[model samples]
Target: MSVAGVGEFGLIDRVTARLTYGSTVLLGPGDDAAVVAAPDARVVATTDVLVEGRHFRRDWSGAHDIGRRAAAANLADVVAMGADPTALLVALCVPTDVATDWVEELADGLGTEAAGVGASVVGGDMSASPTLTIAVTALGDLGGRAPVTRAGARPGDLVALAGRTGYAAAGFTVLSRGFRTPRLLVEAYRRPEVPYPAGPQAAGLGATAMIDVSDGLLADLGHVAKASGVAVDLTRDAFEVPPQMRDAAQALGVDPYAWLLAGGDDHALAATFPPATELPPGWRPIGRVAAGSGVTVDGRPFEGPAGWDHFR
Candidate 1:
């Protein structure tokens, strides 16, 4: 049925009524603004928007996948700043003729993703548009810990990552090539599994600075370099490119380097810590902080696109 038939408030009522909230939310749906109890005092907030054609294709991704990806991207941003995601607010603009069932499934995916990060959907809004656009705002708590900002990285610190590197990029390559070999590649593109616990773990590990690898490793690390006024030297030899990616690279006859070094959207955590710091499980050291600006892969300037920018 068309959203016009249900109207705005009616649609919201129908959509939000199914949401299961966590106790942390003081006031949830049906409020001017959501009231959350961040007893931790410091809160982390990040926002992102996904346009249908620009960010994803409905034909290529399911409703659940879209919802999960949208939530994962923002939650990764919150965690990148060294916080625990506590709540999510999603604003959806969909064409009226869009199936209510699809909308419901999308909400289900959003709730599922938030739950994975120990958060929930407290509130959101819905409107009619010509295409699907999802705007997600994520709220996080610092747990009384000082935020590990991007600017805190220092020379002599170790560079480490807490999640898969090039899986999503490989997935995109497979999708473009019309080859159906690796299921992991497609899953990586559809639902990125961010290391939810690693952010807080890195903070506890005395991480000097942290960021999610939303852009390529070199590009995102450059963000840290610029923020911290230091350089990052990534050791490419440290990376063990998965066999699936190698095979996909062979199939496409493209440089796997771009996927590994320049491709973005994996939402993995990249952290800088003192040389003596101990890394948690799933974290891999791939580089080191240095005393200059810019990023080098194996001590050489990385030549590639800067990263994902809203406007190029």
Candidate 2:
């Protein structure tokens, strides 16, 4: 049935009826505002919006995949601040002609991703619009540890990364070309596998700085470099390009490094740690912090675009 047929209240009830909230949520749906626990006396919050046609295409991804991607983008930001994800407040503006089941599946996707990191969808708002848009606000707890920012890296610190990168961009390329033989890449673009735990873990292990690789790796690292007032030099040899990526690159006749270095949406966590620190599990050393400005590959500027830019 179309959303207009279900009406607002009925649609809300259907989407929220079976959700499971974590302990951080004291009250969930069916209220003017949901209540969440802030045990650390401070809450980490971040918001992101996904607009239909711009951020996603229904022909390429279902409502469920769009919802997961939306939730992951915001949740990853909370974790990047060295906090544990706790709750999500999602607001949707949908066309009246949209299917009600599509919205429910979207809700299911959001709930599933949140639950993966011990979080819940506490509340949200809905409205009618000509275009579809999803805005998610993610809340997190620090567990009493100091929040890691992008400005703490110092010269001589080791740069590390948690989780894989470039898969999503590669997937986008394959899908755009009307080829999906590489299911792995396409799935990545549909739903990123963010390294949620790595954020808080890195904080506990004395991460000097951190960020979620939402924009390409080099672009995001450029932010860290500017904020921390340090130069970042990446060793090209440290990254092992997956064979799948190589094969795809050969088929497409494009440099795989462009995806690895400049692609976004992977949601990997890149952090800087003091020298001599034993890296945490799943974290790999990729570069070093130096005294200077900007980011470089092998002591020189990267040849292509570093990451995503909305206006440029």
Candidate 3:
């Protein structure tokens, strides 16, 4: 069952066998390249690469989880830009010693997660690598709405968010400390619940600025702050820390606030709205924009290490 036994084409055939395509995908796997419909003539595209050991570990995650995480990371960006995800191009690099079944399951994970967002895995490539790596590019349709970039926050815009945060960091802590009581926190690290629908909805309701919480709250917000030449001040009490994080925090003997403030991979949508605009359903006000640089919590600057520094 090793991929080497089946060869590359055989492995590809096995992987594509279960993939289902939707209306957006004019053509799927098997051609030199796949064709996907761009209904708006403007495609919002984003790519993300996940490497084993760095982004995930086989011992800690299933092949399916890895695939889902990769897809989620890329797809969430498109949604953050106010687009409905349509398709994905996933290129995988795996060691020859890996089993073909594992690769196919990875495909299943990608296909299933993409289908959840009405997207298809139209095409990709395969290669041998020293370690397992997955690179996914997500394509989305803007639906005639202006793409929300990170650079539009005004001084008075209210910072709001949809979906919960800090679960993944708590889950990581649980696994690292060998605690097994809170299955919810642990599962969150293994598989995140990204608020995919929240993205376009926020855009529709006039979000002035937005981003996917790929890197922690303060850290990703820093990008928006720097890009928009503004400061984002978040109140400590504005975020309703989930009970799971509170319970996990008690077990870890550390403030759960760190996880909430600095954890990444939550994939929640953080957006800025007019001070008086009503928040969309599922969106909650968390902070406000100011006229300074960097992010502050309770009006104090964040001094801790920013989330997920890939090189340092």
Find the candidate with the highest TM-score and give its number.
2
- When 1 and 3 are scored with lDDT, the better candidate is 3
In order of TM-score, best first, we have 2, 3, 1
Give the lDDT ranking, best first: 2, 3, 1
- Runs with alpha carbons beyond 4 Å of true place in candidate 2: 305-312
Q: What TM-score goes with each of the models?
A: 0.95, 0.97, 0.95
Best by lDDT: 2
Task: State each model's CA lDDT, in order.
Answer: 0.86, 0.91, 0.87
What lDDT tens digits, residue by residue, belong to model 1 across residues 230-266? Answer: 9999988888878888887777775666777777778
- In model 3, the runs with Cα more than 4 Å from the true position are 303-312
RMSD of each predicted structure: 2.3, 1.7, 2.1
Tell how far residue 271 is off in model 2, in angstroms: 0.3
